[model samples]
Target chain A: MAAVGTPLNRTLVRVRKPFSEDRTTAVVATTLSVLALTYPLIDRALNLGALDDLFPIVVYILLALGLNIVVGFAGLLDLGYAAFFAIGAYTVAILTSPSSPVASWLPFELNFWAALILAFFTAAIFGVILGAPTLRLRGDYLAIVTLGFGEIVPIVFRNAVGLTKGDQGLNAIAQPNIFGYELNSSTLWGWWYLLMLVGLLIIFMARRLRDSRLGRAWMAMREDEIAAASMGIDLVKTKLFAFALGASFSGLAGVLFASRYSFANPSQFEFSTSVLLLSMVILGGLGNIWGVIVGGLLLGVFDRILSARATGWIQGLGDATGIELLEKVNLRDSRVGFFGLTLVLMMLLRPEGLLPNAQRKRELEAQATPEGEVRVDETLYDKRGEPL
Target chain B: MQDLIQALLTGLALGSVFALIALGYTLVYGIIELINFAHGDLFMLTSFAALTVLEAFAIGRGSPLGTKVGALFLALLVAMLFGAVVNVLIERLAYRRLRNAPRLTPLISAIGMSFILIQIGQYWKGSRPLDVPRVINRLDLLGPLDIGVRFFLRDLILILVTIPILLGLLYVVNRTRIGKAMRATAQDRDASALMGIDINRTIAFAFLLGGALAGAAGVMYGQYTLTTDYQRGFETGLKAFTAAVLGGIGNLNGAVLGGLLIGIIQAMSERFLQNGSAWANAVIFAILITILVFRPSGLLGEQTPDKA
Candidate 1:
């Protein structure tokens, strides 16, 4: 039976590879770069303010990439990635605040570049602190513990009245400046577009890392920890690196976020934010860099479009119908309902995601059974073909 | 000394509620190895049910003691039924289909379910805290050493009532045929199924039992706290989950111990942390980190065969 299935399975696998060369990677990168460069121009020409919409997408893309390193490559489930984002935002807030000492020491002022670098280190340090004890545990345990950390961080920031101003939030955070030219001009789209360029650079680096020895080791650990360890992978060091590197991306995104908003609040770093970011990674397809980018863009665009128009759309429908019941529908609150529904639908229909990672696509396809039968039986078989 | 005693008592009372909630987590996890994140929301719903029922009766309108007691029992039964139904529905809709999906999928579904419950409650209750009626009379007692223990008669009664009931639960789980089947399913679902156990039904029963316990805890919590809100479940759920982890995820006895420990720690941390009691979460998480570092499997959690 096994011999009979081998040729058919190989044929099926062969038909699935769409773009299979360095040429494809080059084409993707070039197209993305061209699009990134022309985005602001397109926004201005179309009079659509697309740059404003694209800003958060860029942030999310960076974040999803960061999370991809840990959750995707390293197979570490981190539900608290927002804590690192918070660290980045807070670091910039504290250092660049008018009352802070860093303001006096800097030649010009605390700007985006400095903040971005500092945010990386600050968030990375916290990542190390969180990872030190919990990294030894298995996946689910790490997820729960990280969740605890995520919940606690925001609450601590909110309640530490003396330091964090107890929910009023830190405001008037300094914006980015290039050389002597201030990037804080009304045309903030320029700075955001530049950030997207920087995001592309980070993506490039990530792609490189994905194909590197460290990336291979992380993937090996994710697939089989004992096997990876036996093959001379230092579990502690590799896990910490994954955590630290993953955190650094969020940290970078955070600094950019504070600069973009010119404000930082504890409320912004809630579990929902973490979930949203996780959704992006999952939606794109875990462990796939390109998938993460696509997922981020899709989620960011969807959220923006829905939030801006959902209320109006509902009100318009109410007006058209002349029904008072429809008028009372608060689309803002309904957004969460939609989010829940989307998550459930996506998990059920597209568990491997819209753009699954290469390995995940293969695995999901292999485990895909007929619609009625439970998929567990195929996946549950041990080495001896007996159920555990 | 007086403050310490009061804090300890307060902690114990609070811990009892946590223990009750934690039992739901432990029980569900034991059977299915899945954390029912929506359990806290179910608890919140139960509290709302109790509040609504109590308010319906003239108990809030100064009805007599007998009327109030009758209302409370009726509310408890209704809430328990609601919990059981909700659990069954959740199993059928969200968890049943994902039985073989990656672990993360079910967990995420649980989170999604939690948001749905919270949103539905918010929509129903209008996002404000519902005031629980002050129907139970307070009774103070002084012990032998002039201990001056001011125990609320209602709370004391609840603790006394819950203890035997939980013990009865323990007895059922350990001594009954159904209980043996439950354990067998937990140990090996396939093996249990081979031996003629209906795996899905057993899991549903586990969820129903867990939800019922959570329902009871919700009513008790509402009575103690004097208010119930949609957002209450998130924090309460986190704390209970932490307790379940501390005691051992799948161990009933561990959950009880963990809950009490967390309650006491939370109370003491609030008392001692000088910056206006806001460091409660920080302290609790610190304790959690310490425990995870020292004992990742938790105090009573036995090592299971690695499925991952």
Candidate 2:
């Protein structure tokens, strides 16, 4: 596509040399982002009020960024991550919702912005509390405990009828008012702009964290915990940081989610929610920041927006074509099955995921050959609760 | 005292079902050390298998007692066979490749398999728990004793299924050549291989036996609870795994003991505490965390170093 010997082409190539060895891909990505940002504006201007659909996608991506820190970077598989998200949402709901038990008990209502900030710390503290004990446990045991926590937390929230209103959930959660100007969920542009701003900030933070010293420590810890510990990486502190920091972002995402939907329910925070988040991290390719984005967006959009519509579209096509099979198939019930299939297929076929981490890629390559002929590998936890 | 007796009986029934499932976990963990996450779902699916078999025979409450019992025995056989095959297939297909990879890879794969199994259960059985038509007469077997405690045919069903299966498993593990091979392989895989034992075959055998027991537990579980659901596995599986760990993960007898203890605790907690069944799962899980914290080796666990 480059015009050979053209002056403009030579100038563009010279300008792009510092960014990367290849420039077209970067240029395309940049152009796409710019276009994406403007499309919302265009939609608004054209009287289309569909900007609210993006709120969930943006919020989920934020949560993915948080989970990526713990699972992707620290190498801890947190199966109960949605508990933190639940805590975040529930914390906001309890504090700000007029019908909430806390509101009735406390006799004082907290502002949305204040509650939003508080939710982050609240969720982070919960993460640290969970991480403190379970992080000491490794591999499968750790995973099981987290899974238990994930189940137990939602059940507690659901059963604590006096506070969470049982299964009915909290409604009319206070929406955020920045500088006395109310942010409305119906006004698509305001919500979209705010979501995008938070999205960019978290993205920037994730990129920075990836390159920082903590990131290296996480990598070292993930690769070989004994080696990292011997290297004086302060394993406990490093891990807690990963858990707390990861949880903090999930809290923010929850605030946005609650404010947009204006509801918080115990049913929203199930064990499957944690699984969905974990799948996103794995699907994106562990240890790669950009891949998490791609994975989260791919999953979030498909699950939230496209799944039912696509199924209906196919059904419509079948009805038109008089094909009996396609019209009767319900995609909703098979969502979890699809998730399960995705996990199995991805692990077996592409464990490195859509984006591959260089070190992990190397690790996968090394494992490509047979490690042994016919002997069992130590796949169980030893006395120290570490995988042998 | 009467409540205690009733709870005691209930505990035994629950414990027996748990023991059967826990045996599968312990056997596989003993041999391969991989936590088969899908084991629970596999167990759950076995109920559906049993359901399908019963339906095929048109076995329902109206069926004569003789026919009902016969049909159930046949269904249990089919369920066990299906469980064994599914467990073996999962290992061969999903886990065999990552046998030597870092421990997490296979664990995730197992989790994936579990999700698929759970979803399949939902699809097969629908999202809700299905009522198992009570073919077994729920006549109180011990009502004549008049000790103020009632025991039904359903409670006795646990014993009928568990005792035979447990005895059969003990015979197989203690007396069979494959059992010896499994023991040798668990002790030292490399040396076992050097001694001409087929490691993969031994491991697959362990999975088959484990899966069969889990399948048996599913049938027993359905009969005792009088309901079977797609999601039943997660709850039962969690408790059974806890039982496995509590009893010392690799120890066969330990799993049984642990299962009994958890069953007693569940029944006692639900009985003695006011409205306790709602908090039963949380209580059991709490015990698991406490046990893991204080005694990671579990009650009867022997601290064996890496088998390599």
Give lDDT per model, in order.
0.78, 0.82
lDDT of 1 by residue, B48-74 (tens): 877788888856656787987888788
Q: Pick the DockQ winner.
A: 2
DockQ of prediction 1: 0.45
Strongest candidate by lDDT: 2
lDDT of 1 by residue, A1-388 (tens): 3332245444443333322322434565577778777877777798876676677778878888999898988889898899999989888987786644455566777666777788889899888898888867867778878888998888887886666676888877888766676776475666766687778778877878777789878887887789899999998988998899999888888888887787888998888788778888888788877777777777777777656677788888998999988777776776555556656767777877766765666555544553466543232322222223
lDDT of 2 at B56: 79
Cα RMSD of predicted structure 1 = 5.2
TM-score of chain B of each: 0.94, 0.96
Leading candidate by TM-score? 2
DockQ each: 0.45, 0.54
Local accuracy of candidate 2 as per-residue lDDT tens digits, A185-211 = 575666777787887888788768867
